[model samples]
Target: MAATKVLVVDDSLTMRALISGALERIPNVEVVGLADGAEEARALVERLRPDVMTLDVEMPGISGLQYLAELMEVRPMPVIMFSTRTAAGAQDTVEALRLGAIECFPKPKVAVPAELEKIIAKLGRCIKAAKGATLRKAASPASHAILPQIEWNGRVLAIGGDAASTKTIFDLLGSFPANCPPTIVVQHLNEDVAAAMVGKLDMKVAARVVMAEDGMAIEQGSIYYAPPGEAHLVVDGSVPPRLRLLSRDPVAGARPSISVLFASLARSVGADTVGLRLNEGDDGTSGLDAMATSDGYCIKPNPAGGFELSKKTMTQAIIEPELARMVLKLCSR
Candidate 1:
């Protein structure tokens, strides 16, 4: 296998050596440059142009973030930040991730040769994923797929996502008419952040958004979602739908998961269910496939960013959840 090239950037000679030795364990990773600071690192990146960079957040002369901003503007490669996990350090790490570093890992105070090797191995995997981590754009305004012949009869549409998922979900759900289908959302996030996010999602129709609570009978005018690290919000087949709470393992990597909510919606509503998945992380094929296979119409965000498709059924327009609603409304008639 051709070597997966890497650039190790740190101020300490000991750190450089430790990082270098670690890279050797990964079968075909070649250490092209051992840079001392941002200046040297920049030159090395321009010349050697390694596949990935292990950057120290704290470096002399130019700060790591400044260097990162500059590097991204010039040559954007998968950059990983090796930082300590202190409160201050963690803050920097999170900021780096937001600024576009693929992933962030803690750095040992004194690089232990033993642990360093394992770090390098795992880092290689992360770098490969970052390279493939293609951030898709948001979908365009959806068409009026909900036929005018039959309106909101009786169906539930649920949506969910983390920080990156907001824009996409809003665009897809925006297509619903003024009297849109009764919808529920369980966005995996903190309460404050979720509220702040909702402020941005101004639905075109008369859809009211709120933090979901137990026994709150789903109404026609509003939409419900899980409120951060609270209880899991679910829909009971009451009138429109009743919201309930439960304590359980965060399914599909979320407490109030899109999967769990949609799974239940798939159960309660059956053919009257619609769901949308907008995950930024590609954890595994299961969640991706689940979004495709659930009994009800399952709509998956397309790679185009503007289009969505149904894997189980042909014709992207009639994907899961929405398609389920279409059938349910037909039945209600």
Candidate 2:
């Protein structure tokens, strides 16, 4: 296999060096250039054309979050964020993920050798995984455009996706009408980032969007995003349907296991549920299977402008207004 080329971007000289040195030590991984901020990083990205980049969420001139938004629009490439663990940092990291970054890791607070080793392991893994990620320009309708009406369906919709599915998620949610079905989503992301995503989606979609809370009533024309990180969001199969947050250990390595939510919905609503699996792999497939077994309908978005993996196909899915239109047409039937 050819070596993976990486660009390291951060304001801290120490951080850049630590990340560069660690990445270079891994086999078949090469650190091509280093930039101290988004301005420098942008120039380097154009000049070097590195396979992947590690970005710091906070930067001097343009913040990493700002630059990522601009980058995904023009010269899209795989990006991973190195962020601080503070509350503000967590929020910015979440924004970055929503803006299409492939992964986010908390910056090491201490630079001990052991901690450095652990950071190195994480960076290496993220870099390789990101190298294989597919990116496409995001598509959505103008904020002021009039949205057409849709026949309200009482069927419930549940979606599960990974980091690569950010744009897909935005597109899907944006197409819903004010009377769209009660929707739930389990997207594998940091809890902090998940909240930001909910805010953004709410702004774009007619449906009211919010983070799922335990005991919150599921209502039509509203969407609930699953909490990420160590908590899994599940729905109690009771009349009127209530949300639950669990602190149990991760299943299949996902704390908010998609399978857990899918299984719960399968048992609860069965044929009344529609499961949409977008840009996810085997980890989410089992959940879709559970929904299918329970007589729920399942749909996978058609893959579009990204590198094709035999495992997961990439597509704009709901991002494109036409697909969004089609989704509503099918669901209303």
Top candidate, metric TM-score: 2
Once model 1 is optimally superposed onto the true structure by TM-score, how far is the C-alpha of residue 32 displaced, in angstroms? Answer: 1.5
For model 2, the run of ten residues with the poorest summed lDDT: 306-315
Candidate 1 ranges with C-alpha deviation above 4 Å = 117-121, 131-265, 268-284, 287-308, 311-333
Candidate 1 has what TM-score? 0.58
Candidate 1 yields a Cα-based lDDT of 0.62
| Candidate 1 clashes between residue pairs 3 or more apart in a chain or in different chains | 139-306, 185-225, 274-321, 297-320, 297-321, 298-320
Tell me how many clashing residue pairs each candidate has.
6, 4
TM-score of 2: 0.83
How do the residues 251-320 of candidate 2 rate in per-residue lDDT, one tens digit apiece? Answer: 8888788888888888888777877777545566787778777777676645553221121232233444
Please provide, for model 1 over 1-333, each residue's C-alpha lDDT reduced to its tens digit, 9 standing for 90 to 100.
467788988888988888877776676678889999998998888899688888988887887777876676567777777777576675565445444566666788666886665466657776555543444322332432433433555656666555435444554445444455566776554444455445444443335766677888876656666777846676777665688888887665666666567666656667666565555453212433544465555555565543364535664544433643443343243
Tell me each candidate's TM-score.
0.58, 0.83
